[model samples]
Target: MAALIVAAGRGLRAGGDLPKQYRALAGRPVLAQALTPFLADAAIDHVMVVIGPGDNARYAHAVADLPTGKLLSPAQGGATRQDSVRLGLQALAATGFDGIVLVHDAARPFVTAALMRRTVDALQSEIAAIPALPVTDTIKRLGSDGRVAETPPRDTLVSVQTPQGFHFKALLAAHEAAVAAGLSGFTDDAALMEWAGHPVKTFPGDPANVKLTHPQDFDRSQGAPLHVRVATGYDVHAFGDGDHVWLGGTRIAHDRGVVAHSDGDVALHALTDALLGALTEGDIGTHFPPSDPQWKDAASAQFLAFAAERVRQRGGRIDFLDLTIVCEAPKIGPHREAIRAAIAAAAAIRIDQVAIKATTSERMGFTGRGEGLAALATATIRLPEPE
Candidate 1:
C-alpha cells in the first residue's frame, strides 16, 4: 500500500514562521516525523507528500536524510486540505497505483506504527477504515442563542484520526465526485467517502496521536508536565591554509580556515555537543568518530542533526539554543541571521528559539591573535518525566 501525507495547509492557527508540518517538533520537522513510520514500514510501497506551492525547497531540506527510493516527488497542493488530498490521489492514480492508500496529516507527528497497522488490517474486510477514540466527555449541542440544546450520548460519539485506509480507486472516485458536486468543506477523507455512499468502519485510535492545530499545542507544558535540562558546550579550531571557513553550515570568506577533520563549523560543533550533553548522550565524537574516514571533511550540520535526532528519540523538545562565536576575522554580524536560520533548520527548531552572538578575545588569546575561532553554546530542552 502507498501512503499520502497531506502537508499542504498553511496552518496559520499554529502560529509559526513556517507551516505546522514544516515546523520543528522534538528537534525534527513535524512532516519528517509523520513520514518516518510510513517510510520504515515494509508494507508501505511508496510514499508521497502533498505540499503547498513554493515549498519544494523547504520540503527537500526536511526529508534530506530519508531514502529517496521510497519517496515520490512532492505534488503541489491546492488552497484547501481536501483539494490537496484529491490532487495527491490524482498524482498517485497517474502513476498507475491502484492498491490501498493510507491518507494522513503531517501535523499529527505522533502517529505510530501500530496505529497504521490497525488501519491497514481493518481494510481487509472494509472498503474504508479509520481510527477513532471513543468520546469520553459528555457532548452538548448548542442552540443559536448559545445555550445547550441537547445532550448527545457520549457512548455513540468518537474522535477520529488518520491515516485513514481506503481502496485507492474508490477514494479517488469519491474525491472526484465531491469536486464535481461542488462539495467544499468536508473535513476528513472518511466523511467524503461516507457522502459517496461507502461504509466507513472505525478501529481504535491512539490518544497520543494528537493533531497540532493551535499555537498552544506545540507547548509541551500545555499537554503534560515535563522535566527541563540545560547543557553547555565549547569548541575551538586552529587556523589553517584554506581561504574560507564553514560556520554554522554556511561558508564565509576569510583569510584562513579552521584545521579539522570535518567542515570545522565551530558554532555548529558546539551546539551539537550542547544538545548531546542535555540528552546525557556522549559527545559528538562518541557517535561520529574523527578516525572514521566517512566523516572526513563532513559538514558539521550532520553532527548537529544527529544530536537533535537523539533528543527526539528520547522524546524531548529543544526549548532554546544560544551560541557565541569568538573570532578575530570574518565578522559574524552580517551573517548572524543566516547562521541562526541554518542552526534552526539543522536542529529542527524555530529560528526565534536560537540566538547567535559574536565576540572578540581582547587581542590576548588565539582568537584575538587571529589564529583560530572558538564557539560556546548552551542548549535547553524538555522531556517527559521518567516513568
Candidate 2:
C-alpha cells in the first residue's frame, strides 16, 4: 500500500522560524521522524509527501538520508488541509495507484509501526479505518452564548489520529465529487470518506502519537537524557603529481595532490575518523582498509557517510563537526563555503552544525615546503544513555 504524508501547512501555532513539520525534534526534523517508519515498513509500496509551494529545499534537507526508491517526488499542496489532501490523491491517481492509501500528518512524529499495521489490517475488512483514542476527560458542547449547552458522555467521545487508511480509488473519487459539489471544509480524509457515505471504522490509537503544535511540545527535558561525547582526529598526506586535490569532498585546482588509495579528501577523512573515534568504533582504516582494491579511488564522502550511519545506529546524532585544513599551496578561502556545504550534505547534518577553517604552516613545515597537507577535526555527538 501507499502512504501520503501531509506537511504543507504553515503551522503558525507552533511559533517557530520554520514550519512545525520542519522544526527540530530530538535532533532531527519532525517530518523526517514521521517519514522514517513508513519508509522502513516492508508492507508499504510507495510513499508520497505533499509540501507547500517553495518548500522543496526544506523538504530535501529534511529527507536527505532516507531511502528514495519508493519515495515519489513531492506533490505541491493547496490552500487548506483538505485541498492539500485532494491534490495528493490526484497525484496518486495520475500515477495509477489503486491500492490502499494511508494519509498521515507530518506533525505527529511518534507514530509507530504497530499502529500503522493496525490501521492497514483494519482496512482489510472495512472500507475506511481511522485510529482513534477514546476520550477520558469530560466532554461539553458550548452554545453561541458563553455557556455550556450540554455535556456528553466521555466514553462516547474519541480523539482521532492519523495515517488514516482507505481504498485509493474510492478516496480519490470522493475528493473529486466534493470538489465538484463545492465542498471545502472537511478536516481529515476520514471525514471526507464519511461524507461520501463510506463507513468509517475506528481502531485503537497510541497515546504516544501526539501531534506537535506548540514550541513547548519540543522540550526534551521531560524525556530521556542524552549523553554527549567529543573526539578528535588528525590526518596527513604527502603531495603527489596530480594537478588537483580533494578536501572536504570538494576538488580544488592545485599545483599538486595527495598520495592515497581513496580520493584523499583530508578534511572529510579526518572528520570521519573523528566520528568513528567518538563512537569508539576505531579509525576509518578499520572499516575501509587501504589494501582493499574495490575502494581504490572511492569518494571520501562514502567513508563519512558510513561513520555517520554508525552514529545513527547507536541512536546518536552528530552535534557539531569542526575541521581545520593546514596548507600553503592552494587557497581554501575561495572554496570554504562550498566545502562546508559538501561536508554537511555528506554527514547528513545541517550546514551550521559544521565548521571549516583553513590556515597556513607559516612556511615552516612540509605544507610550507609545498610537499603535503594536513587536517585536524573534532566531532561532538550525543547518544542515548545505555540502559
Candidate 3:
C-alpha cells in the first residue's frame, strides 16, 4: 500500500516565509518529521507527496537526509485540499496503483506507524476509514441568526485526523464522479465519499496527532518533547605548566595550562557532557577518546560543536545550557559575559540561552588552593516523541 501526504496548503497563519511543512520544528523541517514514520514502516510500500506549485525546492531540501527508497516523485497539488487529494490519487492510479492509499496531512507530524497500521487494518473490511478522537467540549452549531441551532451529542461528536485510509480505485472514482456532478466544497475525502454513498468508518485516533496552524502552535511546540531531559556534568582539570588556560572557549592568561589531551576548556567540556548526557549519549571521552592523537591539543570548542550537532542529528534541540566555574586564581566574574558569548558561539545558540556563573571553594579544596579549575554544567534538551 502507498501513503500520500497532502502538504499543498500555504499556511500564512503560521507566520513564516517558508511553507509550514518546510518550516523547522526542532532542527528538522516539519514535512521531514511527518514523513519519517511512514518511511520506516514496513507496511508502507510506497510514499508520495502532494505539494504546492513552487514547493519543489523546499520539499527536496526537507527530505534530503531521509532514505527515500519508498518515496515517489511528488504530484503537484490543486488549489483546494479536496482537489489536491484527487490529484494525488489520480497520480497514484496512473502508476497502476490499485492498493490502499493513506491520505495524510503534513502538518500532523506526530502520525505514528501504529496509527497507519490501524487505518490500513480497518481498510481490510471497509472501503473508507479514518482516525478520530471523541470531542470533549460541547460543540455548537451556529445558525444564520447567530444563535446556537443545535447542541450535538458530545459522545457522537469526534475530531477526525489523517492519514485517512481508502480503497485507492474506489476513492479515485468517487473524486471523478463528484467532479462530473459539479460537486464542490466537500471538506474532506470521507465527506466526498459519503456524498457518493460510501460509509466512512472511524477508529481511535491519537490525541498528540495535532495539526499545526496558528503561530502560537509553533510557539507551544517548543516544549513538545516526549522527554524533557535535564542532564548535569562536572569536569575538573588540574593546572599544568603553561601560560594560558581555556575557559568556555575563551583563552585567559593564567600561570599554568590544564593537564588534558586537548586545550581543556573545563566549562566547554562539562557543557558538552551535559548535552550528550541529555541525549543519552556517552560522555565526552566516550566520543573523543583521549587516546586518539588527533584530538590531542585540539580546541575544546570543536568538542562542544560536535555535541550540539549530535542533538540536531537526532531531531532534538538544546533548550538551555548552564555552566558554573570553580576557580580562585582567575576571577570568573570579570569574564562572565565573555564566557557566555564564547559558549554561545561554539554551540550556535543565542547568548541568552547560555548561562555562565562562578563561585570559589572558600579556600577549602583544590580549587581554593588554585591548583586547577573545575566546571559544573547542566543542559536541558528536547527530543521529539518516539514513533
TM-score per prediction, in order, is: 0.61, 0.61, 0.61
**Candidate 1 vs candidate 3, lDDT winner:** 1
Q: Which stretches of candidate 2 lie over 4 Å from their true place?
A: 220-222, 227-387
> Which pairs clash (backbone N, Cα, C closer than 3 Å) in model 2?
none
Give the per-residue lDDT digits (tens) of candidate 2, residues 112-153: 767888999999999899999989889889999979999998
RMSD of each: 10.4, 9.6, 13.7
**Runs in model 3 lying further than 4 Å from the true structure:** 224-387
lDDT string, candidate 1, 1-387, tens digits: 999999999999999899989988756788887887677565789999999998999999888755555789888899898999999999999899999999999999987667888999999999999999999899999999999999998998999998999999999999999999999788999999999999999999988789999998999514455699999999999999989998888899988877999999999999999999998888989988999999999988878877876676566778899999998788999998888877776775567779998999999788899989999999999877776
Candidate 1 C-alpha error for residue 45, in Å:
0.5
In order, the Cα lDDT scores of the candidates are 0.88, 0.88, 0.86
lDDT of 3: 0.86
User: What is the model-wide C-alpha lDDT for candidate 2?
Assistant: 0.88
